[model samples]
Target: MEVIVDPINSAVETLMSGTNTLFILLGAIMVLFMHAGFAFLEVGTVRHKNQVNALVKIITDFGISTIAYFFIGYWVAYGATFFSGAAELTQNNGYDLVKFFFLLTFAAAIPAIVSGGIAERAKFNPFLIASFFIVALVYPFFEGMIWNGNFGYQAWLEATFGAAFHDFAGSIVVHAVGGWVAFAAVYLLGSRQGRFRNNKLVAFAPSNIPFLALGAWILTVGWFGFNVMSAQTIDAISGLVAVNSLMAMVGGTLVALMVGKNDPGFIHNGPLAGLVAVCAGSDIMHPIGALLTGGIAGALFVFVFTWAQNNLKSFDDVLGVWPLHGLCGLWGGLAAGIFGTTTFGGLGGVSFLAQLVGSLTGVAIATLGGFIVYGAVKQISGLRLEPEDEFQGADLAIHKIAASSMDD
Candidate 1:
């Protein structure tokens, strides 16, 4: 029988696919914009002398990340390549291409997170090289393992545990990985000059509170897209994710306000801590569960940041990425197991054992990969600015211009 294709049905399918492509493209843009937040946050935190370097590092890292992920990382993660001709690539409304764009934003965030920790003192070239390797190889390895189910890791989790590991929007995959990787780089880079003197902590006040607050606000706004758009298709979109993100954000903010005693930096970062925690389970979680998860993350950031600053004499994490992203991301992973279960008023498909194993595994891979990458780069090209150069600040030393021309 000669069958006539339905033009209306074909049109609807095209529209739907086109809509989803637009949706993810917007998500890619939003997350891409969050790099500005990362820049400003680091700019505000580091001394004014390094402000120019902060801005340059984030944008440059993003550029390098795009190149690396496009050339290599995308294939590493999903076994897909863009080497196909434009005619083939334009198929399916170019949804696959936009999907790659969306995920590349996530992969780029690793270097952005590490940039904060190593700000002011790191050599620009070596860090970029390390970031290149990380985005091209290290990050995508774990990313494929979890998100694409490569290497049978997810299968192993399901077979061994009651449920497979769950990270709806990459609490462990992105944030935690970035955080722990930052920790390794920070450790290897050592404390910034005079961050400690004779076993005494020296407080470095933020250069610009307004800029810092602006960064936080930008990140908070962009995060809704980050969480909600992980669905990647219009049909899979969930209002529940949006509401959960909102609740978790407020929960984190209030808790940070209380626990941090209204410190502006802590207050601003609170919502981020919450958002990081909630990303793992926003789809399945009750709003209240998300709130508590975020609240705990906020408090954890404040406490761990304070404790690490005071106790870890050799470890100087300038923006506290370790606590905010790494530890809180880890907590979010575990919290998914707790809050994303029927017992906790969630949809129920998470295993605490799986979470524990997966979270720690991410931490391990990121940390080890960070050390190996940074260590090799450090030995070969060196990681830090020279003492005289560091003292001169990255702005003058590397960029040869201060944040303000008047300073010249």
Candidate 2:
């Protein structure tokens, strides 16, 4: 039989693939733009003297993360190295290339999260070096296990628990891991200069509320793409994911307002906590479930942030990223199981035991990785600035420029 080549069918396939590629590319750009949000949030939260350093660190980390992820991290996570000619790479309408870009944005978030926690005092070069390793190895190992099912982890989980670990977008994989890792860095770096004086807590006010609010808004807007676009293909897209994100955002905002006593910082960060929590089960959970999960996350951020700062004298997490990303990420990871079951009006394909084990696994890896990475760097090159330099602020100490020096 002579098979006739069908041009029309081939054309349709090409169009659909092209459309999916465009969708994911846009999502990657949106997530990439959230790095600006991360920068501004740090800039606003830190003192004016550290503002310039805050902005510089995030952008610099992004550049390094791009290099690391492109050359090494991508291969580690998906077993697909980009060591081929450009023509071969562009064959699938550049779909694989764009997918790398999207996933790279996610991997880069680790340093961005760590930057906030270790703000104002870290040596820039050492932090960058640490971030390079994290992107290249630490983050990708867990990413491959959960997202790509490397090393038979997913299969083991499925066989043991009747359901594999389910992180629809990366609550445990990205946000939780980033958060916990940041905690280790913060702990190792020690409290900032004058953050605790004679056993007294010193409050360094945020430099710019408007900038912080702006950052929050930008992150909130960009998060839709982060959650919904995880579908990665047109056929898998779900409006329910979008709606769940919206509900969770609002739930978090309201709870933060109430729990934080209307504090503007908490108010701004509220939506983010919610969005972080909802990321795990946005696909399977109902909007109400997402709302509940988000509300709890917001409350946790407000309360844990306050408690951690007050009680943990050695720890000085500048933007409360530990609570927002770490603890809330754990909650989100587990919440997926509670809210994603058929009994809860969700599309069921989850196991709570699987979630607990997987979430704990992510935590263990992140904490160990963060401690090992930061500890090694600390022992070798040191993590913090000198007392005099720290007192002078990072902008002057490292960059030789203050945020504003009109008189100079």
Inter-residue clash pairs, candidate 2: none
What TM-score fits each model?
A: 0.98, 0.98
Instruction: Tell me the spans in candidate 1 whose CA falls farther than 4 Å from its real position.
Output: 1-5
Number of backbone-clashing residue pairs for each candidate, in the order shown: 0, 0
lDDT of 1 by residue, 1-408 (tens): 124457777888999999999999999999989999999999988998999999999999999999999999999999999998999999999999999999999999999999988888999988999999999999999999999999999999999997888999999999999999999999999888898887789999999999999999989999998999999999999999999999999999999999999899999999999999999999999999999999999999999999999999889899999999999999999999999999999999899899999999999999999999999998999889999999999999999989987746
Angstrom error of the Cα, residue 397, model 2: value is: 1.1
Model 2: per-residue Cα lDDT over 62-121, one tens digit each: 999999999999899999998899999997689999999999999999999999999999
The Cα error of candidate 2 at residue 212, in Å, is: 0.5
Q: Clash number for model 1?
A: 0
